[model samples]
Target: MKSREKAVRMTLVAASCVWLFGVPFAAHAQSRVTLSGIIDAGILYANNSGGHADWSTTSGQLTASRWIMTGSEDLGGGSHAIFRLMSPFNVQNGHGTGRAFNVAYVGLADDRFGTVTVGRQWDTTIDTVSGFASNETWAGYIGAHVGDADNTNASFKVSNTVKYASPQFAGLSFGATYGFSNQAAAADGSSGFANNRMMSAGAAYARGPFAAGIGFLQADRPDAQPAGALGAPGAGVYDDYENTFSGSIASTAGVQRQRIWLAGASYQFFGALTLGGMYSKTQYRYLDATALTLDNYEANLTWQITPAWETGVAYIRTSGRYSGSGTGDAEPGWDQINLGTEYAISKRTTLYLIGVAQQGRHAVAQIYGVTPSSTRRQLVVTSGIQHQF
Candidate 1:
């Protein structure tokens, strides 16, 4: 029965693509599949984790290391069948927590129209806005904005999604996504239709030395589908990352809804230096009429000091306010700085060092993917190697 439903859903998605593109279907001929992966490993030192100084080996400092397989088949008329499968894992012990395929999707692409994909996938925000956010993009996961409240780091992906990506025209492109509820009950015993659905949209433009992007997402009952949070222990998996949104307030009944909106832009100078900035807002709405709102303001500068050496620095200010709870209202905030330098030994291997410092107000200091500090201040430093294939 479940297989039948999935087949029906996939068929509808293909049909929608055909209608959207208004192209006659042709027999698929050529097929190609590519397998690629990245491995990142490092050693880390932190001033505090649950109040204790710690040393440990870490994985995926720059990005969650993952194995990926992408395939495409020519279907004629400038349209094709495409699919992707990816699994992010820790390199240290070779363990990952969550769906076996963190990313699993299949779709149809048309050169004249757009592409449509279905299955578990990313929302538009992570796809569009993350490029300008250094902390969440290239500076390492620890640079993520206060628990990745804005999801620029893609701490979580939406399930049961149908996504569209428009082709670029004059350096401009836009896309949207819809995630089915795929469940029947909300935390407050409500209809699945009343919660658990999701929608997102994004747009980007890159011309000359300038680039910009904007995106937004709304998820009613984010946890209606069972998925482990990335970087945390789940089932038999060990702790690989602790990167949850800090602005969320969870009760026994759970968070009711989530909404995020973000915008970012960047400009390059002399083809050597680049400056970028971004702003984001995330809201965790609860069934008890309570809500936590997080606002992030960030900026970064990166310099290509040499053909093989790259360096950057970034700062983030994140503030949050919680209201409507029985315990009354509270405000929390964090100010963080990140610095990084990397040397590319060759095209596929690199050596890097990263440092982070954070100060908290009305909250415990916690860096993304690390244990929370007992106090309001914390520091983390890591040096690592990354290899890509």
Candidate 2:
């Protein structure tokens, strides 16, 4: 079956190429490819990182800096062959964060059939509903939920995957993805196949300055394991969801199974102001007799004072609970506020400032990519510049 599918895709690409270029297989020049990238950096100060005021230089302040190559070959019948390769990097040290082609994929596209791509890619939730959150839009990860429990700002990707995106119809579209485990036995000499998969799907609608989306994602055996376990020579779960706030209270190591669902919407008024909000629920089932659940609610507003200047503010509340098999239950809630502004130096360059403050009740505060605070409250301020090429 897999081989048959591969053959079909190849045939489609070949047939489309022939029809688009109107030339023999060996002679065609109807393809276009382009390279693009963004570079962003900032000075960061945290009032209480691990109990000390710290200052440092950071990358990806406004956006995670990355380069990409995109190409498309026109197919005769309103169809095309497409591919993209994206590489994210850290400017502070001039190092690539992951694989060279961390977001690489090749696929076929058509106006009527949408697109189908294979290989590593983002899950459905981030692709669909994350735009409604300020964390993903204006404030960066500094405004994201702790540990990125919903995968909005985390280092999570699906491998060995096939994804489908539906063409828009009346401002509505949908997508789905499945990641294969591609593994054998577990580290503990158990069957790993039962708990080694990931799946996600989502839908979105946009019309007349209003947009909304709903999404869901789930993963099995998401917890980290001991070294040389799970048929791999590692101490972490195979295909693990990487968390930036590891060692903090928001870490996901205790989770064995994970699931998340989200809904979000946005609206623009008078062509200058925008309002948006998102709600998400994340559940973590642990092997240590503990279960964790988080409910995140957020709202934000953005104002474009002029073509070159913009500002925004956002608020987020996280309500969480922990249940132990025999222990007890606890409620840990958190409130966060985000403020930011941007001034465009040119069409492809901008300067920005962002501030985040959070107060936790019965919870610990940790901003993504920064050290956790020792107390229940934390603050971070950053100023940065970004350039695109």
Question: lDDT of all predictions, in order shown?
Answer: 0.77, 0.76
The alpha-carbon lDDT assigned to residue 295 of candidate 2 equals 95
Query: All predictions: root-mean-square deviation over Cα?
Result: 8.1, 7.1
Q: Model 1, 1-389: lDDT tens per residue?
A: 00001111112233344564586564333765566677889999999999999999998887667776667788889999999888888888888745588789999999989899998788887768887888664578888898787877776676678999999999999999988776566567876663457789999999999999999988765544443222223324332222354223545444567778999999999999999999999888766677888999999999999998999999999998888856358889999999999898987788999999999999999998789999999999999998777
Q: Model 2 — TM-score against the truth?
A: 0.86
Error of 1 at 14 (Å): 22
Ten contiguous residues with the weakest lDDT in model 1: 1-10
How far is 352's C-alpha from truth in model 1 (Å)?
1.2
Which pairs of residues have clashing backbones in candidate 1?
A: 231-241
Q: Which pairs clash (backbone N, Cα, C closer than 3 Å) in model 2?
A: 20-76, 187-229, 187-230
What residue runs in model 1 are displaced by over 4 Å at the alpha carbon?
A: 1-29, 184-190, 225-251
